[model samples]
Target: MSLINRLLLLLLACAAPLPATPSDLPLKVGLIGLDTSHVIAFTGLLNDKDNPSHVPGATVTAAYRGGSVDIPASINRVRGFTTTLTEKYGVRIYEDIAKMCEEVDAILLTSLDGRTHLEQVRPVLAAGKPVFIDKPVAGSLKDAVKIFQLAEDAGVPCFSSSSLRWYPGVVEVATADFGELRAALSYGPATSEPHHPSLFWYGIHAAEALFTVMGPGCQSVVATESSGAIVVTGKWNNERIGTLHGIRDGKTSFKVTAFGTKAIVEQKSGGNYAPMLREIVKFFQTGKPPVPAKLTLELYAFMEAADESVRQGGTPISIPDYLRRHGQTR
Candidate 1:
């Protein structure tokens, strides 16, 4: 080749845009349900560029409207949420989840009804896409176990968690500020949803916060209930005691007091969804779950055991026995 031609080729190569790397390419995310406020909160943080805490590298490209027709909270607001996602954010709405799955690299199962989570996640798992299931992984403990089992069988990494688990104040309780957590007491609103267990709906937030401070391995659970509140005590394998107070009436708040070997930390402040969204984006990029499937199942089992304890008139329920009865030996 002539020297001039070689110099021109080099110039063109240098001027040409470099091929986009995996990190440079934004990940297309699909939303499976639009009934809850999380749809807006998460989409706004991820899709909006103007937000100061906006997380880049992932966008809600498509969404499927799957709302519970029987639940007024879900049915009455889904249409409005759908419209907002379409008109305000320019997100594509699809009638079928499979079609939406085809266009996105990751999935967020945000359906308000836990009863539908198992079926809703089946196709996504089959497609081998990483998924993040919102709180109340399933309506029943058996189904929760099945959902995790299916994901494992398909070799797809998936996780379910409450935003409270990653709250800044709650997260700090496990750090050096509160060295070696020995016991914790958490309280939050626990509104009951007809289709789901008492704690599975709103109490999961506080229960998750409890587990966050006290790590898993809850051996047994016992509960005592009044007209407006229920207190559940979980005994961990290491003899650590954690309690979750679910308040159904009057003013409610989320607070956790952790007693550690070094110091006692009281976490009264709650954080928004942005912190959790950052983890979700990272998980999607790496194809790894921020929260392990086993730990999530254990959290659900703790709630289920709490329900059983209530059913048995304040009797203690064994976590392992509860898991066994639900056909979840692992």
Candidate 2:
């Protein structure tokens, strides 16, 4: 080749756009449910460029309007939120989840009703997409266990968690340099849903925060109810005690008090969803769950055991026996 031609070729190669790097290409994300306000908050954070708290690694490109008619909370606001997703954020709506899965790289199972999560996630797992299930992984413990097993069998990464787990204060309580954590107390609003256990709905926030401070090995759970709240006490493996107070009446908020050998600290401040969204984005990018499936299953088991305790008149329920009865050895 002539020198001039070679120089021209080199210039063109240099000027041509480099193949997009992984960091340059954002992952395409799909939403499985539109009933909850999380759809709006999450979409705005992920899709709206002007939003102050926008998370940049992924964009919500598609969604499925999955709502339960039996639950007023699920059915009433789904339409409005669906409209907002389409009109405000320009996200495509898919009537079928599998089809949406075909288009997006990852799935966010945000359905307000936990019962639908198992069935909805089946198609997502079939497509081999990484999924992040919102709180209450399933309506029941058995279903939650099965969901994780299915994802594991499929070799697809999956996880479920409450945003409170990543709250600044909660993280501090969980990871501070204080002497070993001896006990913890987490309290928050836990309104009961007739379809779900009392703690599965809103109380998962506090429950998750509790587990954050005291990493999972709850051997026993006992719950008692009063007019004001339903209190659950858990015994960890190392004799570390953790308590979750599910407020039923009057003013309610999330707080965690950690009792360490060196000092005691309480987190009364609140946080927004942005921190958790960042973790979700990172999980989608890496195809790794921020929270392990086994740990999440154990958390659900803890909540289910609380229900069993109430059923047995506040008798302490054994976590191992509870998991074995539900066909979950792990």
- Top model number, lDDT: 2
Reference-based TM-score of each model: 0.94, 0.94
Q: What tens-digit string does per-residue lDDT give for candidate 2 at 1-330?
A: 999999999999999999998679888999998999998999888887789888888899999999999999999989999999999888999989999999999999999999999999999999999999987899999999899889988999999999999999999878876698899999999888899987899989999999999997989999998778999999999899999999989899899989999989888567889999999989887888889877787788889889889889999998878887887865
lDDT (tens digit, per residue) of candidate 1 on 23-117: 79889999998999999999999999999889888999999999988999988889999999999999999999888889999999999999999
Deviation in Å, model 1, residue 311 alpha carbon:
1.7
Clashes of 1: 0
Candidate 2 Cα errors over 4 Å, as ranges: 1-23
How much is the lDDT of residue 251 in candidate 2?
100
- lDDT for model 1: 0.90
TM-score quality measure for candidate 2: 0.94
